[model samples]
Structure formats: C-alpha cells, structure tokens
Target: MNEMKEAVGNWREAKQFSPADENDFLRWLDKADTEEKLFSRLTFWFTFRGLPADQNQRYHLVQERARELRLWNGLELKLRRWQDRVADEYEQIGKEAFAARIGEDYADYINSLTDPEAAPQQAAPEPETAKPAGVQAWSARELSEMVLPPIRHVVEGLLPMGMGVLVAKPKLGKSWMVLDLCLAVAQGEPFLGFPTQQHGTLYLALEDGKSRMQTRLRRLLEGRPAPANMHVMFQAQRLGEGLLEMLGEYLDANPDIHLVCIDTLSKIKPKAKPFENAYDADYDYMGRLKAFADSRGICVLLVHHTRKSKNPEDSFDNINGSTGILGAADFTIVLDKQSRMDDEAGFLLTGRDIEQCERVIRFDKARCRWVMQGTAAQLAAQRRVAEYEAEPIVKTLRVLLQQGDGTWSGYSKNLMEMGQRYAHTELAPNLQMLSKRIQELQPMLWERDTIRYWYNSNGNAGRKHNFRQERADNNASVPVSAQLSLRHNYH
Candidate 1:
C-alpha cells in the first residue's frame, strides 16, 4: 500500500515539478526532515505520485523527482561506477586488436600511453628492404654505355677496388710473375715493391700440370712456407665449361677469397676470331668476369697477350685485339723487356695504377727462380757507383778546359791530372775509358747547354760563351770552328 501511494505521489509531482526545482525541493525535504522525520517519508511519497503520465516525460519526471528528493545522487554514483567498469573492458579489447594487427611491442607501447606513469612514446623503426641474390645480369652494351670509373695507378697509390688485366708477349714469364704475386699476397709479402695486403688467393692455371706447378711454386717459395690461405686449381681444361657457374657457388661457400688469378684469358673465353670483329663476344666474356669479381669484392687478375707489333714502345695500345679488353679492365699492367735475351738487364713494369719504372732482377737458373737483385735501393747504390766513377773524368775535363783556352789538345795528361784531383785511389782503366764515359754524358750536357743558352744568350757578345754574327732574321750564325773561346770578348 505504501509503494502504491509513493508511486501515485511521484506521478502527481511529475506534472507540477520542474527538473531544476526538484533538487531544491529535495534540499527542502532534508531540512524539513531535520525538524520532522515523517516529513521526509511523506516527501518521497509525493515525489513518486507526481510522476509525468507521458512515457518519455514519465521517465524524465521520475528522474527529476528522485533528484528533488536526493534519491538520484546515490543512483548516479552507481551508474558512473558501472560505466567505468565497461570502459576498462573495452580498452583491453582495443589493445588485443592492436597486438593482432601490428606487433606485441606496438601494443605494449600503445597501452603504456594510457598509463599516467608511462614515458613519451617514440615512432617505430622502419623495416629494411631485402637485397636480390646472385650476380645481376649486365650486358657489355650496358657497361660500355655507362661512364667508366676513374683510372687509378696501382703501386703509386691506393689501387682502387676493381678487376685488373696483366698482358705481355708470349714466353715473357707472365704466368710465373702472376703466380709469384699470388704467393706474395697470400703470404703478406711485397710484390715487385708493391705492398701485399693479407688475403685469400685462388689461382686457376689451365695450362700447367699439378706437378710442374708444385715444382715452380717450390722454386718461387725458395724454402719459404706456402701460405695456408692460398688455393690452386689445376683443372684448366674443365674451366671453359660451366666454370663461372661453379665459381659463383665456390665464392658463396668461401666468402674470404679476395683474389682470383686466371693464368690466361684465352683459355677461358669461348673461341672467336683473334683479330676480327668480336666485340660482342669479347665484351660478354669480360662482363661475366667483371660481374664475378664485383659481386664478391674479389680482384680478378686476368693474364693476356699483345699482338705482334713492330713498335716496341706500344704496350697497352698493342694488346691483342678489341680495345674493349683494356677498356673493361679496371687496371692494365704491361711487362716489357728492354731488349731480347737481356732479361737480367732489366724489365719495364708499367701499369694504369703504377708509375712506369724498370727494375733489374736476376734469374737464378740453378734454382729456376727470379729474385729481386736490383731494387730501388740497389739501383740507387749502382747509380752512386757510376756517378763516382765518372766524376773524376768530368772534373779533369773541366780543369783542362779552364787551363788551356777552354779546349784540351790531348787526353793523357788531362786524365792524369783528373785522376789526381777527383778519382778514387785506383782510377778507371785509361783515357779511352774516361773518354767513353764523357761521351755518354755529352748529350745530357747538350740538353743543359740548350736551356742555358736560351736564358743567357743576349744580342751582346760580352755575356755569351761563344757568339756568331747575326743573320738578317736575328738568329745567331752556327760556329764554324769546333774550338771556341770560353771568355766573352765585349765590344
């Protein structure tokens, strides 16, 4: 009965009470109840009884009356508590979704942001792109079309990282020298004065037998131990077929190999016209070789030959055929002998990356080896000796000229006087010997004289060693008499 009465009272209040006024009413009720507890009980009954009859307004009025009576305060606190519980549940669901879509680390980062104690969030790192495997297919046309890398001198400076070709005439010990270089590199020894960086080396000698290679290697080593990192391939005939294919696999298996020497390029490249239009064929072969080296960061040393040219000075320019060969090579080294059968006399070592210099090495026939005998130091010593031997003769000649109106009549007394002043304790053979040495030095003096005459010569004869009447064009007339006075006779 009290419930019914309370409901009826709420409905009635709903018709007359505004939402804002209800709170005031509730405050009044509380005060009223302070005076009379029964007053508070009666107020609840009246609030329910005055509820609005309209469905929309009925709920609104009930809420209003509850507020007027202070009943809604407790209800609102309960509702807020329920809402917070649902929010926490939804937040966890969002985190799980993020974890599935991206990654766990991302989810954790996002979750941390909501926490008051979490640090400032950072951006995720970018993923790396995968590189393609195996050698990239490059046409000779492609390489030819692109600009070339700058040429670098080998021994002169840092040998730029790339492939190299060593070309020489037949029977020039090209193979022996290349093998020597490989052994030197493997052992971390110096090669032809160029420092060798420690590296694993692979030598493919198609022409030499295993036994012969061993013997030659022993000779080259000359009691020196072979570097353990060095590897040799005696299967020259098999190289033509699928050699590159196997090489690709071998390099993959052995990443440490830094140098590869192919004794002769002709052995590997497919048969083609030696002197005809084989640019395409040649380019393809070199392209493959270059690709192999570039892919593995290995230096490919290719042995090659020169065409039979009468011009002895022609080195790189005389390479067998197809300028494409030298064009493709990163470095080109040419081994040339100054004269035939004078191997001991000296050999010229010139290359794109090395300064052109000649060094004399002796061939120890007994041991079948070539050893460094005339290095820069050794040559410098020899030069000092020659200069010492020739000095007395030059001094004697100068003194003789100074004594006798700038010309010596005979060589004997002049030689004796020169020997006394400048020669070592034991002088050179005779005046003939000194004369020969002087003759050798004449061209050098002539060159110096030309420069001196250009600088010193004036129209006045007083400033010149020798003067002739000027022609109409102002050019000095050639001296007729070989004997000329040194002292200038001024006008």
Candidate 2:
C-alpha cells in the first residue's frame, strides 16, 4: 500500500509540466547550465509519466528548449532519445505495477483513477484510443516483404555491424589485437589477412596512459602516417551517467564512423542495483549497447577478460560474466593462447552473421601485430603430414613400395624383418607394434603416396597385409631417398 501511495505521489509530482503553459517549464530549463545538465533534464522530463500527453506538444516544448540551448540541430535525435526513455519507463512501470497489484482489487484501482468526484484537485484526463503495447510478432509474409539491408562488416565478413565482445586473458595481446583492428579499419587496410571496409573508428583506451598508447601506436604504424579518421580517448563517463550520450554525440559529429572499440568493458559498465539479478543486469546493459550500434549501422567491439579458470570444452563459457553478456551480443570472439611464451593464438568466432570458425594467428614481434596463419583445420592437416613423413617406419615402407613397383604384400612380422634387412630401418619392436604403426599411418599413406593398405585374414591360414597404389603418379619415377629429402625441405 505504501509503495502504491509513493507511486501516485511521484506521478503527481511528474505531472507539474504536463499543462499547456510553457512559462514554468522554460523557467525550469533555465536552471540547467551545462550541456550535460541540459541533456539530463530533457531525459528526466521525457521519462516521467506526466509530460504533455500529446506527442506534438511534447516535441514542441523540447524543440524550444533545444533551440534556446543551441541544440536545435539534433532535434530528431532528441526525439529518438525521448522515445527510448518512454519505452524504458513503460517497462519499468509495468513491472512495478504488476508487483503492486498482488492481493489488490483491480476494479477498485481503476475506479479510483477514473473517479474524479473522489479527487477534486485533479482534472479528468481526456479519453484517448488505447495503442498496442508489449510483445509484437511478424508473419512470414510480412518478413518476406521487408527489404532489409545486408549486414555490413567492419572487417568484411568477419565483424558485422552490432555489439560484439572480444574476450581474452590479461596481457595476452587482446588490446594489441583491437588496436591493430582500429588502425586497419581507419586506414582501409586488411586486418589479419581479411579485407576490411574502411571508415572512421574510435578507440576508447581508458586503461592506458597517453604515453603507452602513443608508443603502441607508433609501433603499429611503423613510421607510416597516422590515420586522421581514427580517434582515441583515455577517459570516459560510466554508462547511465553520460557514456551513451557522449558516444552518441561523437557519432553524430562523425557520420562516417563504422566501428567503435571500448578497451576493457569494466571501464563503462553500470553498477548493479540492490537485489538485481546479475543476468538481467548484464543483458540490459549489453542490450542497450547493441541497440545503439544496430540503430546506427555500426559495430561496437567490447574488449573484455575471460575467467581465471578456463572451460576447455566451450570457449564461450570462459567469458567473464553471466551468459546474458554473450546472449545479448550479435557476435563473440574468444582468443585462446596455449602458453604465455607462444606466439600463436586461436580465435574462435561465432555469431549470427558470421560462420563458426577457428582461425590460427601468430603474433609478429617485429611489427607488434597479429599475422593470420590459416584456419585451424588447415594447420592441423599440415602438422599431421609433417609428423607422418618424418617417421622412420614411413620411410622404410615408402622405399619398399618404390622398389616393389608400388606393390607389397606380407604378414606384419615379414614386413618388419624386410624393413630391418633391406632399408636398415626398424619398423617396430614387434609384430603387434608394427601392425599398430601401419594402421596409424594408413590415412597419411593414402593421401600422400596413394598407397592403400588392407589386412587379409584367412580363416584357416593367417593374417596378411596387402599394399597397392591407387593410381600411377609422377613421383614413381623419382628416387625414394631423393623424394624423402625434397619433402623434408618443402616442409
């Protein structure tokens, strides 16, 4: 009951500006001296229940105030700001009202609001048609008819326009990764072997000092001219205080900007209210950022850290927050490094607009940039081939196959003895070991040498092995020893 009374009291206080007269509102605006204060007051005015109910009147008053403050140029933006605030207010009010309605008579509550005789001081509101609210759905036909633009990527086909989180452990070159990305986008250069769409970029390097940032920038630039379209800031306001406003103003001034990177999400994350669910808070915070970026057709990359304990099975689980953080983002990239001393790292990318892929990248110490090696699958294939070719047992089998004119058949024991006698290479310690080694090399042998191997176990006799070339190849004429040397050098 006390909560309901407080809500009514607040509603009445908010109604002070809802009247037709502009004199009192103008007087109130006069007190907001600074630009931030002006924006804050305008936000507060639009958020409460009792601003002019007529949309046009509300806009007119806001326009007049903006014009007086030399903010007339952003009238449309201010209107959007108003709409967003009203939507938020509606949601919050609905939640509170739902909680207040428990054990209360709904018809009595409606009667109290509608009964002008009971409250003589309040004038009756004019009746207006109820508008649709709450969740909305679209039919397939409606969706099909809409011609939405393709998702534009900052790094073409990799980083699309929307909010994304890039998570890595501390001191793992995550900052350098984003810094390089910003430079590439600003200069229209390729990033990590992928083509980029050039445009303006902003890097909020809140944790780094000017000197450190300068040093890193110089290292990356390599004496090249600095990008004029790239902007950096060492400080920023926290979210809900003035951060969104600050970013929006900058974006408004620079219409070409397609990417904004916030170094360390902790710098601008809003504090949670008492008893708030962590997931709800995280989702709401990130959703606001995603909405802002999506509306402008730009990408906001949030640099963040992973948890101390890693989740080997799922890289997304290592992100340093509730699932809501990743759930709200349009995409996520997790950087994993096997060792602090290793130069190579794995980037696991998954999102709505990009395919799930793992890219192998190596840090270039000279330029302080990450160089793309290839996809993880490609690297793994190459590693397997190298390991296969270097095996002594593989060399013996290759020589035997070459001398036998690409055909050899025998039991595991016979093949092992032949390897020791002719090729002078121990195939394996025993018959069972030799059979296991042959099985392990089966795939590599077929792929590299076209030699197919199969076991022929006669029921009454014994198990025998058969090896034959799938087809004739040019490597048949090349000496086996010479081929081995050439393959080693090639790798």
Candidate 3:
C-alpha cells in the first residue's frame, strides 16, 4: 500500500501539469501566504460540496463563502473529475501491461485486486523461510537424520549453494557461459543438456558496463523473451567495506535468489594481502562470501582466472590460487580449452556431493552457448556423426536412440514430446510439424499405409545388431528396415 501510494503521488504530481488550469491554480495555491489565502484559491480549485441535509455548519458556511467569492466552482468540479477519470484509465492500463510482462495469469491478477490492502508487495521477491535462531548439536543415530537433504543444483549435480569458483582463462567466453547458466536458471530452461531449477539470479558484471553486457546477452538470448528472474549490476563495493552489508541488504530485498555470480573475483577483492600465507588472504576474502551463502542457503559463484601451467596432471591444479581459494570453496569448475583460438574444451567438475567428472563441451557459434556432448574420449570417437548440424528435433531423437538398444518407434505426436527433451528454443508447433521433421531425417520408416513412424542412426546400428541377430535366429520375416532404430544417428 505504501508503494502504491508513492506511485499515486508521483502520478498526481506529473499529471498536475497536464491540465493547464490545474497548474495555474496549484501554482497560486503554493504562493498563498496564509490559510485564508489558500482556502480562497480552493473555491476556484474545487466546487463547494454542501447540502441542506448537511448537519455540519462548517460545510454550509464554506459553500456560502464560495458563492460570495464568485469563484469558478462549476468549472473546477468539471476539471477535477476529468483529471481523475484519465488517471484511473492510465493506472488500469499500466497494471494490465505489468501483469502481462511477467507472465502473471490475468485471472489471478484480477482476483488479487479484490483485497488490495491485504496483498503482499514484492519490492524484491525472494523466498521466505523461518529458521531457528539458536544452534545446537545432537549425536545422529539414524541414517535418515544423517543423510543430507536432496541436493538442489544450479547446474544439476554440477553446482550447488556455497562459496564456489568458476575458473577459466581470459577471453574464453566465461561471461557468456555464466550468463547462459543464470538466464537458464531464471527461466527454468535447460543448460548443456541438463535441467535447471528456476530462480532469480543476480549477476554482478563489475568490469563490463551495460553496452557490452547488452550485446553479449542479446547474442545469448537469441531473440528469446527475457527472464524476469535475472538481474545484472555493473558495479559493486570492495570486500571489508560496505560490500558485505550491501550484499546482505540485496538478499533481504530479493530473498528468493538462488544464484549470485560475481564475475572476476580479482576486480572486487581487496588488493592488499593482509594475511601471512598467500592462501589465508584469499580465504579471508572468500570466507566472507561463504558465510553470506551459508546464512541464506544460496549459491555464490565467484568467477576467477586460471594461470598458464606446463600441463598440470589435474585441471584443479591450474586454478591461479593457493590452498586458501581452493579450500575455501565447496565446489570448483574449471573450463580449459586446448587452444585460445578454438571453442572446444573440457569441463572439469568437482564438489563435495558430486563425483569428479570431466565432460566434453563445444561452443556453438550459432547459438553462443556450449553444447555438452559426452566425455572427451566418447566425443572423439563420434566426431564423424555431425550432431551439431542436425535440426533440433533430429538431434534430440538421435540422443534418445543412442542411449539404448531397441526399435524406438512412436507417432508424430510422440516425436514432438520426445524432441522436447532437447528443446532450448520455442516448442515445435504440432504433430504435423514434427512429422515433417521426421520425414526430413531420412530415417528408416514403416509406410505401408502412411508413415507410421521410425528413426535410425549409425550408432543405433551397432547396438541394434544383436537385436537383428535374435530376430533372424527366430526366423522372423519382419524386414530390417522396419526395425525402430533407437540408435538412429539423426546427427
């Protein structure tokens, strides 16, 4: 209600100038020296509303004074009502537009209007939870008590809440990649073939301003709708000053935020290494970030850099830090490209809850996002498949088939449902569109009456070879072409 009143006051002030007569009357009213002078102007500013039924003598006396003053009582009433009507319409239109912008259901928005005074306001929306103020410890005796809650991931089993670091060499599209992750989580969209939990993200791009961030984000979004959950700030305070307090206030305003990314920790980190050990100073800086996340149970991703090393046995060794930065974090992700000129790279992921796994990912120049294929060795063997050039629907079908050995058969409608597994863009329109896509895949199909459905890939042939032998051993007469090739290389 306070927010609404503030907005209304602003509206009144701005629109007061719209009506020329109101502006003239208001300017004079402000200059009035006393209550008598201000009240004299009101007779010309508004009509006196009093009736013989009025019990109050003050109301009758005011009307009598207005009649004696020969003020524009009739015209004043007309202008005030006109201004109010215009303001009312404008407010209604603004509310409708705002509701539509964030995809709020229109019916739900209407129901909320029933009790405007009772409606909760989100100055900065964040999830609300109550916590025990005092901490105590008890010896855990049961497995259930000791087990951690189901892990919540920002990048599904890859990144979770706590002080974490994402290290990559300079000019390696680290910003682009993190922005993609932030936007994906904001929209509940997929990132690198994995599902993401939707939540608001605060991206502090301390180095780059709006123009650079805008162009980079535009490329990442690729004409998609912007996510309301994602916010970007171009500046931030340094640690140990007001930075920690500023972060706390922001989280208080936006309590639901799951991910807070600070690009290039070097930018905002204190320059003086006050501690004795190299690791200690680094840990001291990150320790503040970890404490912040721990208090809120949220994720803090500190983007850092990797120093050039002579082929370190482990990628984690390449991170440009001593034990302080490394030990301070709950998780760390290292993206290392063999060459600065190439987009292909290996993503090394390690965390307390996750297995240390390496994934093969390549930058898609067209989409400006990394495409996760498989382990480096697996991707090396399948380079000839050309999965990158395949249509989204076909590419999705190919992955489904490659996952198992069977005749994966489905109708056109089913194909659309399956294709959504890899959907990063708008959903396919209908069954007809999906059927047309299948026809374009050049798959082995059953078309005795009409194209019932079918798919096949080179990878599927190897896995399905055993299936064919079993059929042949049974003396089955079904044609091999009719086999639903789950391993169909739609790529």
Candidate 4:
C-alpha cells in the first residue's frame, strides 16, 4: 500500500516532466524484457510501485500520467503526434474492463473532479445497451398491430368513463342540454337516448352562471339524490399548462376522477391563431391535452361549435377551426334543426370508429331529452317515405323531355310514355296523375323554359284586315265603330 501511494505521487510529478524525459521513459519500458524488470523500471521512473491488484487502477494511472506528460510537453510537434498514438492505444484496451475495477461510478467520480469547475459533477450514467446499425436503419412494419382503449357503447357504460357531447345553436338550450346530461350521468339514470352507467365525473363549465347551472341541474334531477363522487369545477381557465405541471397537482389530489368535461374549448384556449395556422397554437394546445389524457387514461370530452357554413348533410366537416381539433377527437356529433319552426331537432353522428350505422336522434323539447327517432320497422317505413320525397318529379320530366329531343310539342307524349314505362300495369292511372301533376306544376315549368315566342301571318287578302299599335297610340283614337270593324275583320 505504501509503495502504491508513492507510485501515485510519482505519477503526479511525472505529469510535469519535459517531452524528452517522457520519450526516454517510453524507450526504457520498450527495452525491458521480463515482467519484473518492466515493473522495476516503471516504478523507478514514476518513483512508485506501478503494479496494483486491480489492472484497471494501474491502466488508469498510466493513461493519466501519459496525458499529463503530453500536456506538459506543450505544442511540440513530435510530442503531439506521440500523444495521439498513445490515446488510441489506451482507448483500445477496453474501457469497460478498466471501469469495472473501481466500479464505473467511482472511476467517473475521480475523472469528473480533475477539472471540477469546467464540468459539472454528475452521477455516472448507466451503460446503454448497444443496438445494431441494421436495427437503427430498419423501418418498422407498416402493418404493425395497434392496441387501442376499449370503447363503452352503452350510456351507462360510457358515463362512468367519460363520453358524450351537448350541442345546439346559440341560446337554443345548449347549456340546458349539457346540464341535463350531467344530472343524468351523475345520478346513474338514462341519458338522452341511452342508459348511463354511473362513475365519478368532473364537470368544468366556465360560461354558465352558478345559479342558473344549479337551477337547471335541479330541474334535470327532479327528486334524485346526487352522487358523492361527482365533482364540479366552475373554473378551468388554464388547461394548456404542461401536463405534469397543471394536471399533475390535481390528479395527485383526486385519483378517483374518471370523466372530465370541459363545457367549451373556446374558454380554455388562450386567444391565439389556432384557426389560421393549425401547426402553431392549435397543435401545441391539443398535444398537451392529449398527453394529459394518455397519461391519466381519463376520458376528456370537449364541447365546441359548428362553422357558420355548416352543411346539414355532413357533420365532421362542419366543425369550427383548424381541422386538427376534430382530427384529434375520437368521436364527433352534430345537432341541428331540421326546419326553422320544427320543435323536434336531429343529431347526426358523423365519426365513430366502432359503429357502421348512422344514427338519427330527435330532441324532445318538452322533456328536455333526446330519444331514438324510430323503431327498426318504423325506421324502414321512414326510409321509404324519405325515398319517395327525394324522387324528383321535375327531374324525371326533364329527362323525358331530353329523350324527346327537347321539344315541348312532344313533351306530353313522352311524359305519358315514361309514366307507362314506370307504372307497368297501372299505366292509365299513372298517366292521369302525371298530367294533373304537370298542369299543377306549369307555372314552375314555364319559368324554367329557355325559349322565346312570336306570331306571324302571310299577307293574304282575308288576312289583310287592319292593324293597330294599341299601346303606341292610346290617345290617338279612331272611331269606335271603325275599331270594332277592324277587330272583327282581324278575327
């Protein structure tokens, strides 16, 4: 041990030696033939025993001495070249084996403190497993199977996990609808068109008045008791904060929360250009929310509005803002009025990965609820009605006219033929109905006409009675007898 300590001190002193001396020491090591001779010479030069039970400690000391001597040599051409060669040889000796001697941790600790102010002292990092170069370059399989969260179909099953949307035009019972769903879900009752299973929920509504929300909830629940697990948050104005920063605190406190509802996304997102540029503010905000959901495995339902140019035929394409909003959503639904005065409204289910069926739900304003519009058989009947309504009579007439070479003179005959063709054995009744319907639709048909009309007469003696421009000479009157005579001759 004393010899080892002396060798360590000499090694530190050797770091200050000139390049010529370092060269002389290397030459002496090369000349030594036996291990004992080599050890004795190294000890004499370093002024310490060069051997330790651990080969790593011995090699580390030798490398350290080499580095110090090279630095002491300071910019000499031959010395610099020699230092590079020494470093290559040192690295080739297997750092892991050397590292294992004092344990990699202690080796790193000693290395770090050599220049304490220059580099931060840190815990030694665990050795990373070496991946093959081929693996690094290889692409993942395109058809790799993905694991997705299970979907709950029933309202009872959905309510517990968080699912549903309340939608309507402004001031047309949107809030009221949401309140109703919340009350139903909280009480484990049947919710608009579906039965809800009970689960702990978090309701966060920023826009609603406290009193109004409470009153509406009371109306929705009527006499039912509220669930103790149901929680309400009147304010959630800052949801975009880092997941671990904002929600981490809340989730730590309330681990039981399963369903989370943010009444409107507009209130939560800070005023930014989510609409103009999707990748900027919109992506960042949604990314944070999605990460939060994934980490917690909680269902987050966000209520939003339809675009001003919303098409009744399509629902998902009509949602407002960067398509990213809807693109990120797992499910999307739209509520719309079928007519201006119709009390019954419809909800169009647009995007749901699970169901192939398109559902049409009717809103019962009196009960403030949604109910499935028709039974299976009733649905078939309604489909027939819809088919009949959509079968365009005018379009059929236009097609007939086209087939008749675009002449109104042959229009009636062509119409009769078409009626006969379509009516099969009921031709006469069909023709009669067609003629009546056409007569009833004449004004509309004439308005759609693309032709002009005029009248002409040959200058025969019988046709050469009299002519007058009545409007041109209203006050330039001729005798009443003459005018009567002229009218009679013209006729």
Q: Of the candidates shown, which would achieve the greatest lDDT relative to the real structure?
A: 2
Across 1-491, the per-residue lDDT of candidate 2 in tens digits comes to: 34434443333333322321233344444433334445444544444313132223445545554554455676667667756775666577664453233212222232344564532232222234122332234456645754444556889878988899999999999999999999999999999989998888999999899999999999999999999999999999988999988987787567677799999999999987899999999999999888788656578999999999988899889999899999999999998988888999998899988988899999999889999999988999989989887877777777788888777878877887887876688878877888778877877787898776666666755667777775645344534643453354334
lDDT per residue as tens, model 4, 1-491: 22322333332333322112223444333333333333334334322221122222333334433332333233335443644664464367544332222122222223333545533332332244233422322124311322223444325322322233434455555565565665656567776657875545677777877786677666666667666767776776565444235444564346555557777877787567444675456666766665565444455666777667866666656667776765555555566765646654555553444342344556566566566674445677777556543445445545554554543232334545655564332323554465455444444444444311111223441111112222322344645655564354335
Model 2 reaches what TM-score against the true structure?
0.62
Candidate 1 Cα misplacement greater than 4 A, ranges: 1-160, 237-240, 273-276, 344-491
lDDT (CA) per prediction: 0.53, 0.73, 0.61, 0.48
- Candidate structures ordered by TM-score, highest first: 2, 3, 1, 4
Among all windows of 10 consecutive residues in model 1, the one with the lowest summed lDDT is: 448-457
- Residue range 362-404, candidate 3, lDDT tens digits: 8988888888978988886565245424457545555554554
If scored against the real structure, what TM-score would every candidate get? 0.49, 0.62, 0.52, 0.46
Model 4: residue 201 alpha-carbon error in angstroms:
1.1
The window of 10 residues in a row where model 4 has the poorest summed lDDT is 461-470
Q: What value does the lDDT take at residue 196 in candidate 1?
A: 65
Model 1 lDDT tens row, 411-484? 34345565687544334566556544544555444342221111123353322222122224445443433223
